[model samples]
Target chain A: MIWLERLLAISAKEARQLARDRVTFGMIIGVPVLQMLLFGYAINFDVRDVDAAMLDQSRTSLSRQLVGDLQATQVLRVVREAGSERELRELMQRGNARVGIVIAPDLERRLFEGNRPAVQLLVDGSQPALEKIAQGLGSMPLLKRAGTSATGVRRFEIRTEYNPARRTAVQIVPALIGTILTMTMVIFTSGASVRERERGNLELLITTPVTRGQLLAGKLLPYVIIGLIQTTLILGVGRVLFGVPMAGSFVDLYLGALVFIAASLSLGLFISTIALTQFQAFQMAFVTMLPSILLSGFMFPFEGMPAFAQAIAQVLPLTHCNEIIRGITLRGATLADMHVPLLKLVIFLVLMFSLAVTRFRKRLD
Target chain B: MTVAISARGLTRRFGAVTAVDGIDLDVPRAQIYGFLGPNGSGKSTTIRMLCGLLVPSGGTVNVLGHEVPREVETVRRKIGYMTQRFSLWDDLTVTENLDFMCRIYGLDGATRRARMKDRIRSYDLASHANQRAGTLSGGERQRLALAAATLQEPQLLLLDEPTSAVDPQNRRDCWENLFALVAAGTTILVSTHYMDEAERCHRLAILDHGRIAAEGEPKQLARDIDATVIEIECADLTAVRRVLVTVPAIRSVAQLGNRLHVLMHRDSADPERELRASLAGQCADARVERVGATLEDVFVAATQLRRPDVERAA
Candidate 1:
């Protein structure tokens, strides 16, 4: 009972202090809303409106029909017309167009023989994402669908699931839950201990009968609530503004988020123990935040990363949280289905909390 | 008298430099004991060691009958410590700060409210109870710090320079409050550089360069000073001081307004006649007389006499 009383004393004090700090209080609400708007609207992976240059040598009605079909796909727009092959190359070189379409001079004869290629597609190889779109353009049955009917065999059928429309907001909004929680939670608790030392409060506090465990636990209590509030805010905005679907239960999402919040807070407290000043604590928090954002599969595909990078990403709490959130919100997966990532989050919380408690000493020296 | 704190051969070293070197102390119970020294004389370090806020590199400390750093938890429950700086939460109100301290000390709700009310009344903080601590004046802040430290009615209070930032009027009021606490049978160990504050202590220790040069009752130490005190009044006190320093027996010279107070070795049988002889030609109208030693004279003799280079530099 006494231990609980002492722990609550510190927690109450911290909550009061946080309420008095205007900038920090503002950040609790402001950071989530601002970041939700920024990441949701700015990041787009559905590539469209690529500029292309066309060089039609046949001068026949069939070549004109091919151009119209390419435009109908909405992937490439013929922004410029070239007189010859050399002129098409110049358009790509000058950065005026990212894709080039060339029609053979004997297009009708080649189609009749079914031996030589009737059309050539030249794409700029500098931008990888745009180049992939251009490759997709090359495989479309433009000549066959344009009425020639040369090749009619279909090899395989592909289907898109979960987000069938493939909207980028749908992908980024759920991941924003992990990103926003990681940023705010880690930064809030990272400066707790260092701020006490800098302001000369640690000397007085340590001399009392309070234990190290009580101190750390009390400091982390308020920030945990703040993290949950931020998670709810992001989810609400994503659902209303971006039309992101939440197919899973809210209880399951909150349960997973609670563990991730504790893990991030423990990591901050661990940083607080090692850093000597508030500035140093902030710098160290940022260092951890960069990796969580970049390597946590929040912005890039996890499978696309190198082996060593994936190995490192496995250690970060954000990576597992992103998987858990995305699984629940988009795939309608239950906690039982994503037990692996949830278990990893609990392990991370235990490891970081133990390290923080061990590193923090009660004495000044 | 019973001993409240007993330290022996207390040593602390920070790499190559020793902050506190082999200090031996026994502070009596229910008395105002003081550590009188200049800045960096290890006053704060010794206080921290006693409270177990710092680990002594080499000695043993027994505070309030509990061994320190080993039985530190037992000691912490019985004693209250105030740091050199105002370490209370600046953003919290005075009442809130006291309430927090009370809860940390594990007082019940009824007892917590009673203690907060009593502290607010006694420390004259009723008017500022709702104001944030950061907005309080220096004197009010010091009073609040004292009230917070004593919220649990600790048996022994360790205060490190508790009145350094207050004005003289507030300082006198602070000492009066300390005396009141002592009257209530609480032992206080305070460290200070002010001579007047040191003189008020029942017992005192003079620390210099990480060592205790002298320790005893303030008046008793002054009575037993090893140097002879002489006061000289003249038209030009500076010229008399210049002439007096050349005398091999004189250890230190200090000017007090129009008079030059001189300390000579005790072996000088006729210090007054010797000083007159030294100042005969330069300031023949000077009056030289032997005087009783004050606490400042005792402090100077204890700390500055043995280090002649320091004396010369001064």
Candidate 2:
């Protein structure tokens, strides 16, 4: 009878508290809608209608036909036709065209004589995603020529490297590392702190002989352990299912994660210091999450952005974090190569920790 | 006796608002000092500053043998503070929460475990040791918070409105625990709104608008009010209250269930004798009984006296 009464009492209290929070209830339902609409409208992996400029050194009928066939697929458009290579190179540099197709003057004779033809495709290497797209689109002409040569003489040979499968998951999983950590740290730590203050436990804690630093460490230590566990879980799944290789030392990865967790925990502490209510902390967490997820190279590639946008993205800890993770995992980058990003993370940790400690109220205000 | 807490012109300012105004206070060791005030009267603010959670803008606070905001960590280690709210893990069991506190305080091994077990048993919470704190009742949660704060042996215990949400029975239990702590040579400064609880303190400070309006023993403050309560029982007691309201000698008239208690400013007026003659013809069956004043009457008188001064200051 006692056990039954306890169970009923606990469930009843839980239900009552859950029912009282209309906003959190709404968010649980609304968040999926928001994510669906955002992903559905804005996220697309398939490249289409990329601009191109032509520099036809051989103004031959064959060259014109090849250009026309490439344009017909709509992956490349001839935005400009330059008379010289210098002009073509300038056009590419000016961002007018993503791809520059140059055909040699002897293109028609070389192809007719069953000689392997050469077409130089000048792609902007800086824009990796668009460069990949342009390269994928540029391969179509060569494939068609290979088919046309019945005597086993191909006009051109195309080679694709680095993400040949063009799988979006490869690019997304590395970025997801930052997103998952930020989400976990922000939600759990801030929520815990705010709830304590809201429920009057903060007062009890303050009055204790425990220093503010000790209290902060105590409050944050559990969340850090939880954050690391979540990181391991995410990385584990990525490895088992997606075959994400551990290129760098696992020690290095964990160290990087420790820095990230420290930075994120400091941010959470700072937010808790400023916020009076649990609802306000939730709002602040969301406000911080949007920028971290969107601008931190998690959902978008930082290399494709302009210099100013890159500078803005640099301020986010996730930007450096993604670079560190991806470079180490994919490129097998050593500590020397990962030093700059690691340095940035260390600096972020220092700044966040210092600010949180300085502003934290040790006494009741 | 050495002072456990000593503050001189202590003040705390939050931007434009002064939460704790300039005030001087001293709490000797092993004494139960009660800070009695309504909500937003700076009791919590004063407690925080004394505990080194906040730095006073313009005052020196020496609590438990160290200056505040400088030796905060040392002082904090010697003080146990229980805030106005329950702050423990809702998902963790009682034993787990206590164990976590021990770890945070850097306590370990058999000592931490044995002491925690003893605390649970002493608090009558052994039956629910495995139960989550969130699943406990309000009174039980208070007990948990109390137990967590006291696990470490601190010289001073700062309780901020500890019994605000507790039931009357639990509030009584909390007071008993506090008194036990005092008996064990721990100085206590507890903030509370309940007068009955305040009356139990060694001495009480009545805080109003970030300043102490009065500070003395409950009986002493009541004596300072110099008011005697006269209980009047008459036919249609409503008529007696109405008559007393118009009389200048009668400071206030309140209904305590059926009988009317008339508060008189001076005994020279002899409210009982005067009221008896006035109501003799209207109701010959009227009886007047004089009674001792209570802390509630003192609180009322103190607040009433300060209103005009507060208006002028405003």
Candidate 3:
């Protein structure tokens, strides 16, 4: 009973201290909302409106139909008209077009003559995503129709599953929940202990009847509440503002989120133990944030990264969290479908908190 | 009297530097026991060890019938510790800070409210109750700290340099509050650098280089020192000090206000005549007389044991 009371007392004190610090309180809420909104707009994977220049040498009805088909796809917008292939090359070089299409002079004549009409497509391969979409979108329809007309050999169709509209906001907003949670929870948890130690309030606490485990729980309880608020704000903004839907179990998503929050908060606690000053702890938290951004596959696809990078990502709690969130919001995955990610998150939480507790020495020495 | 805090050969070392060397303590219950020393004298270190905030590299410490470092948590529950720096939450208001401490000490419900109200009135912080602790004056902050420290109603209170930052009148008020605590049967083990503050303690231990050089009642420690203190009033105090230092019988010379306090060897039968002869023979006009020793003299004597000249005098 006394242990429970001690925990409650410490939790109450921590809650009051957090409420009194208005600036930190504002940041705890504001940072997640702003980050969600910013990522919703900035992370567009759809990659539309590729500027293209055309060189129609045949000038026939058939060539006109081919160019119309490319424009209908909406992936490539034909922006400029070039008289010759040389002009199209110049347009591609002068930054006027991301892609160029050239039709042979005898394209209709050859097609009616039972011979193949050769068409050339040029693309700027600087950005890999745009290159694949541009090439596939700009030529696929035209090639399929022309090839079917000429021969009956190859036949296949492309179908997009999950997030069929390929909305960038949909993809980004769900993942932003994990990224934003990681950033806020790690910073707030690490900063709380370090700030107390730096400001000398820790001396008063250490001298009390409070044990180390009680102190850890008390210091982290208010942050768990703050983390929940941040999660709700990000999810609300993502759903209302960006139209990001949650297709899976809310229970599953929040369970994963709870584990992720624990891992990150304890990670912050671990950093605070090593960092003598709050500023140093802040820097360490930021350094951990970097890995969440790049290695956690939040900005990139997990399957697309190399094996070594995936191995690195496997250790980061954010990687598992991002996967869990995306699986729930995008795929409508159940707890059974995401047992690996869910279990990994639990493991991360247990390991991180154990290490943090070990590192957090009760004595000042 | 029951011993509230006692230690045997308590020691604490940081790398190559030993902050608190082998030392022992015996503090009686319900009295103000002071630890007087200069900065780095291990006063704070010893108190921290007693409070169980630090683990002694070596020692046997028992506080309020609890063995420390093993039963430290129990020791912590029965003692209230106040550090030199403002350890309470600065962002919290006076009332909020006291309330927080009350909760931490497991004070609850109406009892907690009553204790807070009593502290707020006695510490003279009734008007400043809602104001932030950081915005309070030094004296107000000190009062608020004391209020928080005593909120638990612990049997022993450990205060580290509690009056170092406050003004003279506030210091006196703090001592008055300490005396009030004593009257209520609360044992206080306080550390201070001020001689006047040390003199106020019922019993004090003078520390130097992490060792206890002397320990007794303030007056008794002053009266029973190994040397006689002589006062010389003169125009040229610098010359008087310099001339009195050359005398073989004079152990140490210190200037206080308009008079030069010269300490003579304990065996010297007539310290006043000896000082008068030394000043006149050295062509300095001065009137000398043996005066009763102050705690300051006892402190100087205890600390001077570590000095080379004072060692040579022995």
Q: Top model by lDDT, which number? A: 1
lDDT tens readout by residue for model 3, A1-365: 76777787788878888887899889987898778767787777677778989998888877888888888878788999998878998998988998888888988666655466456778887765777776566336464565446432336765667788778788788778789888888888888899899999988888887778888877887788788788888888888898888899888878777878888888998888898888898899999888788888787878888999899889888998888889988999977788898899888888888888788766788
lDDT of 3 by residue, B41-129 (tens): 99988998888778999989999998998998888878888999988988889998888787777766799999999999999999999
Q: Which wins on lDDT, candidate 2 or candidate 3?
A: 3
Q: Name the candidate that leads on DockQ.
A: 1
TM-score of chain B of each: 0.97, 0.91, 0.95
lDDT of 1 by residue, A258-322 (tens): 99999999999999999999899999999999999999999889999999999999999999999
True contact recovery of candidate 3? 0.86
RMSD of each: 2.1, 9.1, 2.7
iRMSD in angstroms, per model: 0.7, 10.0, 1.4
lDDT of 2 at B108: 50
Ranking by lDDT: 1, 3, 2
Ten residues in a row with the worst lDDT in model 1 chain A?
A: A149-158
Name model 3 segments beyond 4 Å from true: A55-61, A80-94, A102-117, A143-154, B267-269, B281-284, B309-314
Output the worst ten-in-a-row residue range by lDDT, candidate 2 chain B.
B100-109
DockQ of 2: 0.25
List model 2 lDDT by residue over B166-253, tens digit each: 8999999988988888898989999998999999999889998888888898889877875777888876887776667666666677
TM per candidate = 0.97, 0.75, 0.93
RMSD of 2: 9.1
Give candidate 3's error at residue B233 in angstroms. 2.1
